[model samples]
Target: MSKKVTGNAFDAKIFKRLMGFAARYKWQFIVSTISAILMSIVSVAKPILLQKIVMIYFENKDKEGLLNYSLLMILFLLAEVILQFLFIYIVNWMGQHIIKDIRIQLQKHMLQFKMSYFDNSSVGKLVTRLVSDTETIAQFFGQGLFMIISDLLKMFVVAIVMLWMNWKLAFIAFIILPILIYATKLFQIAIKSAFQEVRIQVANLNGFVQERVTGMNIVQLFNREKIEYENFIKINNKHKKAHVRTVWYYSIFFPIAEILSSIAVGLLVWYGSLDIVNEGITDAGQIIAFIMMSQMLFRPLRQIADKFNTLQMGMVAGDRVFEVLDTHSQIDKTGKVEAKDFKGNIAFKNVHFSYIEGEEVLKGISFNVNAGETVAIVGATGAGKSTIINLINRFYEINEGEICVDNQNIKQYTLKSLRKKIAVVLQDVFLFSDSIFNNIILSNETITLDEVKNAAKEIGIHEFIMSLPNNYHYNVKERGAMLSSGQRQLIAFLRAYVSKPSILILDEATSSIDSYSEKLIQQATDKITRHQTSIIIAHRLTTVKKADKIIVMDKGRIVEQGSHLELLHKNGYYKNLYDMQFASEVA
Candidate 1:
């Protein structure tokens, strides 16, 4: 869930950090800023030129002077147009380049985070941070900061000119200024809250839609379409309300600004006419210039309020993005040892672990597997069978205990080097939406097509793959949905075999396949595990009977460890489990 933004609408620290991304393109940023200032200075020249033409040329009927000043005003207008274009183009270019760098850095950081971080984080919210929030930050440069600076500069220059021309009329013009400024301040505060709510609703709406679409199959199977639709309606309604609240603020603020601007103009005209008649203090040309200056000053004051909201939204987005970047969930990769020629010997000594703090998942368990030995673990659900597989790979840090490989602590080896020596084929296989060959090689470039075909042939699934539409080039679609479950399992076996890892783990690899695929998997299994250290976690008792040794677990502890025949004869936990399966098969 997103936290509410508190304190000031403008966060200086976050703004500075966001600007740091622009340091690489400092030249472009500087050019844009200079262009914006030039544009503002150019904007003030038109009113001053009008005042000069009216005062000097109109009274004297100097046609040459009038023509010269008119031409000069045209030149300034053209210069302002060119400066405006440069300012917009350069700032937007800088924004795009900065966001690109930030996105790359953010993704790289996220890739190194620990698995536990992902286990608790929402995928949709992470997507929001990566895609939408970063885009908003980009607007901070393109539309918010530079534009506001230009508007404020224009207002400042116009205000100074107004006071210099006629002090009394300028004072009348600014009488309504304080009221407008206070109202703008109130509107900014109110709209900032509204924009924050809008952002939150957008994230919620994204998260809900993503989850529902990914689980559409389950929704259809369970007849939950109507219920889910109703839930979606509720979320969508809240999103609408949040946006309407922002619109409501806009609707109220702009009209008040327009009315106040009109009142400032009216006050200027009344005071200037009275001063001209009673004291002959001001002329028509000065009054006209002051009126123009009043508009120039108040226009940006109104626009600044709008631009300030844009700035505020960007700050909100920056806060959310930095929150993700600031997370300290990365795995420690300080181990310097490289497992160049890792042996497959493994040991677990009194290991303790838990996903949650208070509840223990693997409690004080000890086990060992000799080099090049094939071991099978059999147990019911939640018996810590798969947790052992996760521990060996260092997916999660253990609470208390030592896991050693090759008589040295696994922590001594770099994570990349250690994982490279181990290959896992899980029960629920996942394949990318790509060709069979690419999925097998996983874009490694080091593994050739010939190598993959040879591995498939060694696993005895080459002929099966050849029968597919495109052979090794067949596209499996997302999650291998185009292939049968058994076919996916065969592909997984080939993938693991091609890696040539020192240790191979098959967790229920044959659990849900047909008899033909199971036979093929068994042949592949025997071929691959013959000279490799392998761990097989299976529910089928028949598959483990020929294993060199079987470890039976119950509730996170090793209840029995022996050969299949020895455990069957002992009439222990393994005996009861084997008899129950045998009875079910006979019935």
Candidate 2:
């Protein structure tokens, strides 16, 4: 999923919020500012003292003043070293703290987003957004903040010293300033383009690898090892090309900046030498001092040039992360109004829904399930059996009409209050990479070990868990790859039933369990569904035979609905469904 890049290009205004992100640890930034300023002051003093030592001490033989100036220069050098260290440390502290907050906030925001957000979003893109992209942005502010502040300080101090010591020489050097600025600006553009290319390629590479790693089982099952290997190489080649382009740009700019700085120094020395020869005024030390100062000025000019590339990459990544954080989910519970209790009465009134434009998946569907009744939705593949369950639970908002629970419109109730009473087990079960106990708990409050064991026993997987070396402590790998399909489904069943919801939706929940486990779960289901509103979407007709009401759906519409024996007598859609699964019907 390639997100359209909308990086706020080198905008000074965007950085205002960037500053706000750092405000949480602004004291560290203050310390960094002080350290950087002090360092700049000490650095600029040395060349002035050198010129004085040459003109007064060496030429006029003033021993006392020379020694004092030399001692002061040494002291300034020491101060510069200590302050530079402090500056680096403080800015780093500030940068790292801001990164931590941004990452945590990004995850929290991701959690609050609607389910559709994940449906359209890619896991690999999000991983890159959270990990590599966050790191790059953090480093940009960390190192880039120091470079900006420290260099601006050095430039200011250098300009002042240049004017005070020898205004004429300073004027000669400043003549080339416009040309250098133009060159750096153009070079920064080149590097920015290069960095953007690198960022895009890196994001693509991450996505490719993440998808492949996630679908490893599918790859092995189909015997597509060579195809997978080729896919990896294709992305690797793209990354290499991008990296080479970045390095190529860097190589050119570094040398060009160096040559320009040297030419400016050479011109200043050429002009300053003529004045010294004509008046016999300037000494060797002043020329050396001039060279040192020129180099000092260009050093940070070069750093800003290099760091601009990093800044560009960071901006690209920061924009991606902010997109997720800035989005407001379609479902929000901010109204402060809520349904106090859900008695399991679900009412759908003229509900119309569609997953795509110009095509209705559920059309003007109206139905009512009274409290504590068992409702089974039966349908062909394209029929809206799952869609109806989805609408009742308010997973997908209705396009037209309203759904009510316990006599109140669902939209008026807090989403938490609306969903707290519902538990759904989809055909595909997802388990986290945690212990079996935690997976059973499934983001709800932790349950007692006894409750976990009992839920497992109800699903008929308890004795099997104890048979393993870790039992309840057994580690379930990603999606429960370490366990069998039957084991995974049984565990997912416990996760749903243990919540004790007022309403239960089992969409082919027992599809994977063995005959023995199915028998056990059927027994437990009878007691659990006694007074709870149950909606079961069955593939095996016999599993839902005892449901109080059965509704048959076709082509996004309900074709027929009645009690099991009543539907069978009608010999309609449900009758054909029963005939199709005859073996399971009589099992």
Candidate 3:
């Protein structure tokens, strides 16, 4: 990926967060910095020590001086090796620990975001952000931080050694140094953008592949394999182009940087030898030191180039990571409101709501249900039936007015505490890939097997579990794909029962099941709702016939609401709906 991203994606705050998190490990970081300083000085000391050995010990033919110098150099190198190890180990450990904290915070923040955010984002992209992108950010802390420190220290040490050798030649060599640094930085920005494009294309490709593969059966049934393949090819080509662009940038960068450094080193050598011959004041020691100075300066200059390259990568990955970190989730529980008791009495007061603006789904909705009441919501598809229950559950905030639980406005309660009191078994049942017993009990490490069996039995799924080869210990496949739709729904019902909630909500809970399973569900519903406040949203008119209060809604408004017998007597919308279904069954 290119090192430089567009100015649009650049976020100073994200950079601050990244650096600040690493800064938390102050002691380890301080130690690493000290080690770099010591190492840089010791490194330069090697050449200085060599110079002294040659001039004083070797020239004078003093064997004792040579032996002492050799022993001291060995000791210095050993200490340097140990310090190098400590620097690497401390930095690595701190970076990983900081990353763990960041990941946890990112997860918590993402979970709080509104469901609408997810509707527009692909699950594959989100997964990549959480798992891969976060790791990239952590890597900047571990590798990038240490490299920058070592490079800068080496550069400073080289400058000092160069000044001590021949100040005039040293000054001339570094004249183009600022320009080289600036050019690399500019190239780094370009590289960052290239990498960002690559990441985006790759992320989109992943999303396309994941969704297409998961629904491969549908694609094959429709005979659209060729069409899907073409779509895949388009994204794949885009990714390839992005990678190629990055390569091209580096091709230009490395060569230009190499030429500049080479030219500087060539000048240093030519002038140093000329000055030695012409002035007669420059000695062999001076020439050797000048050569050493040339190497020291050029070496780190090359490394600084590579450091900027790594920085570009961090910028690209950081942009993607910050995108997720910046998102605001839906569940806002910042209010300090606490709800101690909800008596299962839910009321919607002048509630006005809409999934989209100026297209209200529940307009001026008003209703009240006392504790232990069974109220059924009957409406045609898109008649705002599900919206009613969603409002009561506080899944979506109403545009205007209040929804109260036990006369306390839901907004007045903390989201965590309020949601815990309600249980819902939706039509789209989702089961984890776990044993049947765990699926039912869900959190029964302490709860007994009898409780799991009792809940399953309540939903008439106990016998089925016992019949399984390993019973509750049997592992389920993804999405409970191994189980029948009815079986999955029954497990969902048992899961809700395990919560022991005051309010029970079933939004078309039995829509996909066979007749026998429907009867089993109906039987379970009857017993479960014996004394609980229940809300059933369904299209089957017969299911709500025995309800004490049956509400009929249409076009975002409740047209008629009364007992089933009362609506039938009036021969209104509900009566017509029931009669039409009854006539179709009879035919």
Give the 10-residue window scoring lowest on summed lDDT in candidate 2.
2-11
Candidate 3 per-residue C-alpha lDDT over 30-75 given as tens digits, one digit per residue, 9 for 90 to 100: 8888988888887777666666676665368778888888788788
Q: What is the alpha-carbon RMSD of candidate 1 to the true structure?
A: 2.8
Candidates in order have lDDT scores of 0.87, 0.79, 0.77
Per-candidate RMSD vs. true structure? 2.8, 3.2, 3.5
Error of 2 at 426 (Å): 1.8
Residues 117-144, candidate 1: write the lDDT tens digits.
8999988779889998899888888888
Where model 1 places Cα greater than 4 Å from the true spot, the runs are 1-7, 273-281, 463-471, 582-587
Assess the local accuracy of residue 551 in candidate 2 as a C-alpha lDDT between 0 and 100: 79
Question: Which ranking of candidates, highest lDDT first?
Answer: 1, 2, 3
Which residue window of length 10 is worst by lDDT in model 3? 1-10
Stretches off by above 4 angstroms in model 3 are 1-13, 53-58, 119-125, 175-179, 255-269, 275-296, 312-342, 444-446, 580-583
The global Cα lDDT (0 to 1) of model 2 is 0.79
Local error of candidate 2 at 494, Å? 1.0
Scored against the true structure, residue 45 in model 2 reaches a CA lDDT of: 81
- What is the Cα-based lDDT of residue 460 in candidate 3? 82
Report how far off residue 506 is in candidate 1 (Å): 1.3
1 versus 3: better lDDT goes to: 1
- TM-score for predicted model 1 compared with the true structure: 0.91
